[model samples]
Target: MNNAPQPHHHLSSDEIDLFELFHAIWKRKKWLIGCTLFAGLLGVGYAYLAPQVYQVSSVLRPAAINELDALNRSEVYKLPPVDALAKVGARLESYEARLSFFRANPALFEAFQRPGQSLEQSFEAFNKNAINLTFPDPKNVDALNGAIRLEMQYPKGVDGVAILNGFVDYAIKLEREQVSADLKVIVNNRLNEIKGKIDAARANYETDKQSKIARLLEADKLKRAQLEDELSAVRLQMKVERSNRLVELAEAISIAKSIGIKSPTTPSALGAAASRGSSQVMRTEVNNQKIPLYFMGTDVLEAERTALEQRTNDDFTDGRVAEIRKELRMLDVNREVEVLKSRSKEDIFLRDVEPLWAEEARLRGLDIDMSGLKLVTIDRMAQTPLSPIKPFKAIIIGLSLVAGLMLGALIALIGHFVQARRENGPFPMPDRHLPHPQKHTH
Candidate 1:
């Protein structure tokens, strides 16, 4: 009998037999089908439980900055640019003010209310899907197309457009109020600083002026006293000269009487006393009688006396010229003080501060229109969506079907391997060639 040793053909696990794979799969077909159908049912039930959501969206266009409009509008209130609206929108997220606003208007947001839930909780839940702000360029904030997009989602029964509009208006108003308050605070601080500087300047000017005025008044008084002293000395000199002239005149009259001449009593009054011994008398024929004429004082002395009298009457002793000079000097000093006071009142710091004060006032007062500061303009209102955006039945079902098939196939493969190991042998290891040991007959 030819009973020779047969060579063993070892198979690696990598060498998969398509026939064996089909046979294993076929053996677990019912289990795989059952797993698939169960997963699909779970998916269908999940889809049914999920609420349908409707989305409402709108676009905001930036308002053009018209120079004429800015001029015509209140000078203190200016509008913010379109790009600023995106920043404002970003700020609106998670703001406590927005929550308070929602609570205040409970009726408007009745759709957001949940039974036994606090207002804060309800509002937070609603915000999860309620609002979104999108910019044209995500990386660059300034590169805006002047269009800000707003999106809101709500349950199937709620009117998304109406709610979105209400929220938008509320947000815009809140943002504007906050911005105005912030600007008012900044402007007020600046104005206060400027006012303080102006006040200090005025105070310093007044203080300096008072010191200068005191010095000027004291100087003027000293000058007036000196002038009075000089005038009094002149008066004493004139009095002495007058008395000497009288004595000379009397003596001359007595001499004429002693000469046995019929002469006027004061005829020699003008004669020079120092030259009396050499004096010459002149005679003139008048009415056939010789008449003698003589002066009461020397020509030089008489001319000096005449000039002194005229000076006393007009300029020197009359005190009019000195009084005029003092009056003019005082007027000039007073005029200078007035001018300085006026200039101090108009300090440059005050001029710079008043406009800021006006702006602060305008911001504080809510009566003024601050629409110019609005960064966002609703270019298109949000439209009410006729259909639900979420709970996409077709997509959800398709994804679930794929996931179920993959899971069922994986479980089936594992079961097939386990069954094979129990019935025949262990799984073949890859990459190694091992021969089955042949039974040897000695």
Candidate 2:
């Protein structure tokens, strides 16, 4: 039953077979080794020939409380140590601050200059990744004790330590200047506010003084009017009384002449009887009634009426009139109003300005000098590094050797397929038919 022999079927070329592929690669082991050696040699050469890059770093921490005591004690401005450290860090990371430092110190960045590159271009390149700031992670519990690290990556010949330390100093100085300027502005603004208040107080004092004078003058005016009215009334009364007295004296004189009386006399019964007999007793009879005007003789009444008529000023007739005249003269010029109006320095009289002046003086005496202020404490100054950070020799050689092995394997596979195609047509042919072995004769 077709036992002659069946041709063993070989695997198709369209599918991959790991065993055959491994076998092919093992056949070209020398080529893989040689390529690996060549690539490793190239890596070593590059590691030695390439320019080295060094890194210098410094650590910054918050300043001590005593270092910032003066600033806080100023009362005008307060700067905490932690915040000061943060500000210094921010300044260090600033592009403008870096550019300013680069421009101010030309010799420090001389290594950054190269052929065909302008000074600006060199600075730009130098500024681009040369400086790095590393802050402590906030999630860590020990972050409070951690510090900010400033690192600078520089090429072979540059003084990285000097540049880093100088940058730190520059940043601190800038922060100090800014703090001092801010303090000055705050103090000056407060001073101006105090000055304005003083001026307003002075104006208020002047206004108050003027108001007082006006009140005094108005009161004096009203009092003078009342006094003048009283004086006029008194004079009118005196005039009317004088007229009445003159009329009375005429009546009395008529009565005295009709009775043949010529002098002031008292009407007594005995005297009247002696002078005019019983007929005079009727006129001389005295009762509880007041004395009659005719009892006074015509000569005395006529003299009193003449005196009253001739009196021009009745001021001496009543003591009240003299007192009113004196009071009116005093009211003519208000002494208090004159004193208030003549005052040149009115602030001294104001009671509200004492505290304000004291406060102004206190503010003026405050010390705003921040020259000795310390913003940050340098935990570690930048030191020159002993070795370069770039060009990892071991890693470079390892990766190159791996890559060369891969490339050599691919070339070996391609060469094996090409040679197979030439020997056995387009695709690789299966194993050829095998010859049978002859049977042994007994």
Best by lDDT: 2
Deviating ranges (above 4 Å) for candidate 2: 1-37, 114-119, 137-146, 269-271, 275-288, 401-428, 432-442
As a TM-score, model 1 comes out at: 0.59
lDDT scores of the candidates, listed in order: 0.64, 0.83
Best by TM-score: 2
Q: What is the per-residue lDDT of model 2 for residues 227-310, given as tens digits with 9 covering 90 to 100?
A: 999999998887787778789888888897788667777667436557775572335344797777877877887787788778
Instruction: In model 2, state the lDDT of residue 92.
Output: 93
Q: Compared with the true structure, what per-residue lDDT tens digits does model 1 show for residues 155-202? A: 877767777777777777777677668656655665676567667766
TM-score of each predicted structure versus truth: 0.59, 0.82
What is the lDDT for 102 in model 2?
Answer: 91
